[model samples]
Target chain A: MAALDRSLLVVIVDVNPAMWTAEAAGEHAPFVPIIRHLCMFINAFRALDGGNRLAIVACHAGKPTMLIRADEELDRSLHTVLDTALVLVLLATPDDPAQYNSVMNCIFAAQRAAIMIDCFAIRTSSTFMQQAAHMTGGVYVEPTAQQELGLAQLLITLALPDRACRALLRQPKAHDVDFRAACFLTNQLLDRAYVCSVCLSIFHHGDIIECPACRSRFPPPPRLARKRAKRAVAPAHGGPVIGGAHAAAAGAGSSAPRPAL
Target chain B: MADGRDARDARVSPLITFLVGQRRGRLGRLYANPWTCEAVVRALPPVARHYALRLVALGDTGDGATFAPATLEGWSLAHDAHQAALQWLLDLSIIERAEQPGALRLNAAFREQCGSLLCGLRPPAPKPPNKHTPSADELDAHAAAQWDALLYCVIHPSEWSDSTGYDMPAALLEPAGLIAARRVRARADGDDDDGDGGDDVDDDDGAETIEVWAMSKRGATFVLQDLSAQAWHILQVYIGDDERKLAFLLELAHMDFGHGYELRDEHRPLIAELHHLGIVHVRDAAKSKSFYPTRLAAAIVSSGDISPGGSARGRAIVESNLRVYVYTSSRAWTAILALFLRLRTLLPNAVVASITRERIQRAMREHGLSAEAIIAFLTRNAHEQVRRRPAEERDKALTVFEQIRLWERELERFTAKEAYYLSDFDTLALFDAELAHALASGTHLWHRREPGNARLCKLVLHEREDVIAEARARIKEFKRSAGLA
Candidate 1:
């Protein structure tokens, strides 16, 4: 294959006002160091290839929006242009669940275009962003609060390679993807939830007759005799349960579920 | 110099090779020129370019004068990237090892000039503006026409009607071994082996076909490369034995396309030289005395995607049935197509053709074209219809592509190498000892003991002289010990 002459990089920053404020209350201002490192990383990428481009997207109040474009002035209200992007870097924190759909739409679109989405989670771990990175074959980095290995160091080491060079470099492997999807109804994380077979939308309640997404009617789920003893048999695990209905229900109700998928 | 040969053997990009092979004083002088420094930095590989930029960035900040080995560790570079970047820097003389054991200092001239260039601190040298400067479209047209004509002249000499009014110096190309001229008798003399019947036509009824200059293997490889790569290869050929000429040409790479530079007395010959190579176009031969750098010139130091008129993307439309429709009216492009395709018809805007085994084999055997080269050419010029599809499914002629590769592999199945054989040892002890010696030297190919003859053994292809002498001495010693001399 001919060498790639140009590559488009899209950086997604999670700008949750609350998280930044909480982080600022600590010794160091949280966003300041990250923003500085991000600028350096962008410069490094631009210096690497003159034709390489960058676009900055900010996830504000659960709404995924564009903050800056390589050519255009910074605009907070604009939607991201992900079509031409070869790599998407997301600086995420534990964000609002409400923006999950829009953020996921962007992630899926980037995935379809074969755009790698690298997620650098700050203090809080954003499960959905992790899923975005994992599903799209990107790196998911969670830098420790310690100053020894800073965000700039991680960015330079892990996220410098474009698509072509990524093939040669050894990427950081994601331990386990959090596949626990959010419910469409309440936006709550679901474990042992009912899946709308037609639309595949997860729901916390199994008693509903119709899928809220597809509006398809279904025959009632087979009712097994309630067995409390069977639910106690399986131990509580941190990972998402990957089994049929029986294991899911027992695993979900038994413990506080970890966010994933 | 040995460095030039090393560059040639490694096939380094022409610009970088030129820079690496220059004398230290000349190189420093070249870097002192801001335009040349900018062009050299632009032509560097991405990782090396990044390292230069990073160092310049550091110099911009009032940091330490030299970077310690630990500074690179702070960048957190991967092992391979760090090694590659350092090797390139050292090879290009961009950085030198410091007297201090673990430190490196950037080349002072390169650092200063490149920093100024990158930081936009140094304005470009003043050049007088001319009134008859060509537009971007005009420059593109001139580049395309001139480049196409040059290629057509090299590959299809009979079709060289001098339509572009640009004459390529065949003597100049001879040293590069890109094309070779051979005298052929007129077709009327009954030489039926002119299979294609394309370039063998007589100009006049009584005229002979005469000399036919056909493309050599290097020329085939040249034509198959992307236009930017082709320009670089040609430039390397033209810059042979002239580092000063290359330094001037490298400066041209930093010039903006469609911009006119006044033709100074010193630049006139160089400009004329560039005009011959299709890198620059003179605005007017009579009144106007300015030259415009074409897209080809600007593209040399920039990315490879900047083809003439942006037609590099998907120019040839290949159908699922192995038929091809190339959307180009240039005679040079058509001539290239004729190399491997059996042309059925030619339209004003396109040429219709199909892949035939006989035509492909003829190209492989006669023209020295490889299957990979053909595939690359097709892929580089694939039509928009094919390009718009997902990359995995884009090659509609994939089956034919595989078949062409298989055919090429068939031709490569047989190969011959030079080797020496050792045989007729005096005894089993001598044979075993010689075999051990050959095996120890790692020069042994194969060995065998003659059936029903325990005294004789053979070893094939031992290239080392010392091993052969030792084996001979051992055999003689064994013969003398047995009193059989």
Candidate 2:
């Protein structure tokens, strides 16, 4: 039976320096105060449903990291409960934002050492905190630097119930998610490019005589001699022949089938 | 745990081994906590609890389950722990497992029995209850109220002392040290002089409380008063051997109880009480999970139609019924059944008895049985049959209207009997004592009392014990007030 009473709520507190810096400049609650308040709110939620879950996400520079993931396992597979926080000490460095994965790895390793517990992903997902909470049927809360939304209020009201009983009420829904794909070619997000009709492969400019995806060849046309033969057919025929030449030309034209991958 | 296991192993034998192996079959899942154990414990009736507790205690280690089939009772420990515990522990987050294998461990902080997590364990502030105990009079009044509640379940408040069986609940007697020894007395055929006319009567001895097993004036009053019409009828059929209540329950399983009756956890107790009453029998089905009703349970519903037969005919029914059903046929059931006439039946097996309309009408007329009382008798018997389905079933099949009709015709022959009247009391003290005495005698009724015009409290009695007892108490109080005693 679907347990109608239990629920899990995961609050991913994004502590990215670049993101929070912008927010800190705004006329809103400072990031530190928000984090402190969010922790207390999480405690309140745990009191409501003592078994409800909470996770924190910190994004520094552009790398998203986890500050606190309740460690009940010891594996990378969302199942491991390790008291590990992925904190990036090098957030102050002006490194390329693309080095985010490396920063995340360091943060995860540091958090693991602090707890001295193994990490297992048996029940949790791959993302810094969102995926872990998602696997366990918990709510995922990730506040970005761009919005000065009332995240604390949202946490209190929305993340109260455990996952089992949360189905009846309307909750925050993610509709237009960022589905931009990272290119295998340059490892950068791609917008538009030549796609292989047969294999659905995408590519930049290549030889016109050959298809890059399937390596199929296309024969070039003999231009001058073909035009001279057309002139010969027009003189040999009368008005019917002029029209016959057009018919013959029309008959000669044919389209090839598109190639399969 | 090991010491307990060794003791259990010492008692093991070949037949016992076979029984334990058959009972255990297999144990599945592990329950390591008291929270889990409590769920399984509550589902069991007291008898099952007695055995199950012994079984579990003999083998259970206070940790996650370790199935040691050979060590304890020679049975496999393959029972599902969560099922036994009813999943309450899962709700508490004290134990986490999955319906299937390979589920990840959700992280939870482990708290010890330390000060950080203790919520409600403050030492309660001392109170002066021990220092200022209630006075003797107050204690007596409090004890009376508590005793009344327990006793009230057996006999209705108005008919408390009038029950013929006079069997007080064990709870009441336990405190009073009035429990009768469990010995069957030697019976004298014709030599027993049962009347007040007997030579050299030993009546002044402790005989005041030692009423005869089957018949005594106070005991008969109590037994009769204890008879709700339906229960009385159920006893009648069992005595008649018409049908065992168990068989009736099996047939009733096919019938419907109106209004989607959802049998809840609480209803189990009420059903168990009926079983305890010896009105029905439930047996474990062969190699199955649930219990099946036996043949004796079948006639429970029909028994409800019986009116309270008077003492003469009722006694015969009780004796005959007692002879047929050896187990669970209580003295109270037999006494209640003795009210009808010519109850004997020459049956080869089970009960081959028949009750006539004339006998029923005669019983009503002689015993002053009310129409409501007669109907109540049949309905209570019918309920055992009806309970086969869970109480929460949509349609309850037993018809109350049918039983009521049976009594209406039977009651026409009865003549009104006058009860004693006591009124114009000068003091509250007089009125209260008289009321209590009247209630104790099991004959008090609000219907006989009128207000303002009469200035009198009236009580109707087929017997005047209620009034007589009350009058005696009032006279004593009156003398005490006048300083004559």
Model 2, chain B only, scores a TM-score of 0.22
TM-score per prediction, in order, is 0.57, 0.25
DockQ for the candidates, in order: 0.06, 0.02
Tell me the deviation in Å of residue A10 in model 2.
4.9
- List the candidate 1 regions with Cα displacement exceeding 4 Å: A1-261, B1-14, B17-29, B60-67, B99-103, B122-131, B157-167, B181-213, B241-244, B285-289, B390-396, B413-485
Query: Model 1 over residues B262-297: C-alpha lDDT tens digits?
Result: 666666656665776668888553445567777787
| Residue ranges of candidate 2 with Cα displaced over 4 Å | A1-13, A17-29, A53-149, A159-166, A172-179, A187-261, B1-485
- Residue range B178-269, candidate 2, lDDT tens digits: 22222122334422332222232334454333222122222223334423332433333222322223223323322221111222243333
State the lDDT at A92 in candidate 1.
48
